[model samples]
Target: MDSSGWFMWALLSAVFAAMTAIFAKLGLEGVDSDFATLVRTAVILIMLAAIVLVLGKWRNPLQLGGRTWFFLVLSALATGASWLCYFRALQLGEASKVAPVDKLSLLLVAVFAFVFLGERPGAWSWFGIALVGAGVFILGLKR
Candidate 1:
């Protein structure tokens, strides 16, 4: 099986995301969710900065155009909001159920890509999204 590098990276990301929810849930015990998110964000920022430095990928910040800055800033703001809400949800809910609900973003992203980016996914992709939706609904039930 020849797996693309992008697929491998995405797989790793999913694994890390799963671990993140469990670890965060445990760590958030008796802690403020907002404070936990701040600490997590700070660690991520420092780690990413270290990677940029180590890889010598630094470039002139001024080189980025306004359009780039606009989208990147918006993405950053969205990410921060999502994290805040997610952490708060995790603080109040069970990780097992919360994580599946959070993963509903995958289906939402697919639909958003089709609508906003003009990237169309075919039948199988739609089936996958439906399956994801069903899975989320199943996990959400208090059985």
Candidate 2:
């Protein structure tokens, strides 16, 4: 729960996300997108349940209130939708291309945070966003 722990979690998440793209591309070689998504979701759910049980956090969900539950459900649905689209894209396009396009969501998130969360990123952050945009544009032009 400390800063280093959070950083490690973020790093691990990124690694796993990259691996997900590779594995998904392989898995979708001859599979329909929808069926691939279902299989992926089922496997992730089972893995998550095992982790929660092993960590003794199975009851953690019982601590959520109505608003938390609503948001959690909404987030899960959004995640599922993202996975569906990501897999579909992977099935139909190059992983390098699809991954960069998917990462554009970070720009969208930054804009949303600025508008809704009143977050004002400093000059460096804005520069980083500009660079990401440029990179995405260049990636798109590659094909």
Candidate 3:
């Protein structure tokens, strides 16, 4: 994908993420966190299956070796855990509060990317990270 395409995807992802927080908060009003997570995962699995079928990528999984399969399964498990924690947080706190705390992952990702991926952030990106950290602190102070 081109840089602009990647940028658009990131922007769209942020929008959807904000909407997800809102929806999760609303959905968890009377539901238990575990049940909500299971329902959400089921829906996501169905959607992902549809996308895989549409892109003819279902067969691509068959070509994976043992190590790749292990990592993929590990990643999926990690994602499920993160989703469950996120929904539980939403159920326990205000969306405005929980969402920003969840977004602290961006700072973690930046640090990990620099250390592992050898990807460096620009000065502006560093400034943005600082701002995000400050915002998270401010949000925490309200609790």
Candidate 4:
């Protein structure tokens, strides 16, 4: 895959993420959100582990550098927190509404990248990010 391949991969990720919201909303019925998150995490762990093993990508965590391990651990923690909140939100609200609010993260990511990663989005990129923020707010409005 080349640099241009990323868009297709990202598009597929969006598709799967959409499915995830719908499926999780239905699955949350009669289940505690925290418990549901644990189950979902376990399933993800198993599935990713299988994929890694099948692809010969199983790696020894101990062999990774400290910086890599630290960032990976932090990212995992953040993902866990996000999943917990997302599941709880889905449990309490309509999936359509919850998912759009959840996408406010897209706006946050742009800001975070600029501040922490020294990323500078071009004018149009910032415009797109602003549009995403506006869309989230519009979708989340009580109507």
Candidate 5:
């Protein structure tokens, strides 16, 4: 894919993430957050499985490299934890507030990439990350 294609995909991801927050907030009514998370995970698993099968993209998991498997497992664990916390937050807080706080991960990702991935974001990129941090901070202030 073209290097520029990432922007479009990232934009779509943001759109879907916004939808997820709204939908999850509504779905949490009269439901346990953890259970709701499980249901959502199951749905995602089924949907992705179908997509993979339809696209003939299924590969033997056992054939993957140990490092790949390890990191994928770690990533999956982190995602699961994030979903659990997000669902609970949605259960107890306003979606508008919770979503922005959740997006604090964007700033965290930049910092982590710089430290662990040896990714030196340019000055403009750092400026953008700072803006995101400030936005999240401003949104977090109590009325």
Candidate 6:
């Protein structure tokens, strides 16, 4: 596998996402989930803003087209909603169960991409989605 590639970054994302569930779950102890989510979002905002400032990506936003702005804003809203729901879920349930069901977004994304973006998954992609769904059902669906 290439060390410096998109796949590597995506793998890192998965690792970090797993860590996020554990860390957030731990943080939710004796705290309101919504308040925790607010604090987390604030920290993320600050960190991301710092990174963008340091990297001089401030100009990047100005360069975005209207479509890019629209989509990104929509994505931001969706992400916020997801985080809120996820934190609430994590607070109320076990991370092992919550994370997998949360990840069913992957399966939904495949279907959504096909319908909305005209991005059809090939046979293996479909197979992988099915496999992941089944795995999640087995591992995360049971109480």
What TM-score does prediction 2 earn? 0.90
For candidate 4, give the lDDT of residue 46: 96
Candidate 3 error regions (>4 Å): 1-4
**Which 10-residue window in model 5 sums to the lowest lDDT?**
1-10
What does candidate 1's lDDT look like per residue over 25-141, in tens digits?
999999999999999999999999999999999899899999999999999999999999999999999998899999999999998999999999999989999999999999988
Worst lDDT 10-window in candidate 2? 1-10
Q: Can you tell me which runs of candidate 1 are displaced by over 4 Å?
A: 1-4
For TM-score, the strongest prediction is: 5
- Candidate 6: count of backbone clashes, pairs at least 3 residues apart or interchain: 0
Error of 2 at 119 (Å): 2.3
**Cα deviation in Å at residue 143, candidate 5?**
1.6
Cα lDDT tens digits for candidate 6, 7-108: 989989999999999999999999999899999999999999999999987885688899999999999999999999999999999898899989989999
lDDT of 5: 0.97
- Residue pairs clashing in model 2 are none
Tens digits of per-residue lDDT for model 2 on 1-143? 67568878888988988888888898898899989999988998999999999998777667889999998899899999998899999999989789888888888888989998999999999899988888888888945
Give the winner by lDDT: 4 or 6.
Answer: 4
lDDT against the true structure, each candidate: 0.95, 0.88, 0.90, 0.94, 0.97, 0.93
The TM-scores, one per candidate, come to 0.95, 0.90, 0.90, 0.95, 0.96, 0.90
Candidate 4 residue pairs that clash: none
For candidate 5, list the clashing residue pairs, or say none: none
Per residue, candidate 3 scores C-alpha lDDT tens digits across 1-143 of 67568888898999999999998898998899989999998999899999999998777667889999998999899899999999888888889889999999898899989998999999999899989988888888943
In candidate 6, the residue pairs with backbone N, CA or C atoms under 3 Å apart (3 or more residues apart, or in different chains) clash, namely none
Backbone clash numbers for all candidates listed: 0, 0, 0, 0, 0, 0
lDDT of 4 by residue, 1-143 (tens): 57879989998999999999999999999999999999999999999999999999988888999999999999999999999999999999999899989989999999999999999999999999999999998997778
Evaluate model 6: give its TM-score: 0.90
**In terms of TM-score, how similar is model 3 to the real structure?**
0.90
Worst 10 residues of 3 by lDDT: 134-143
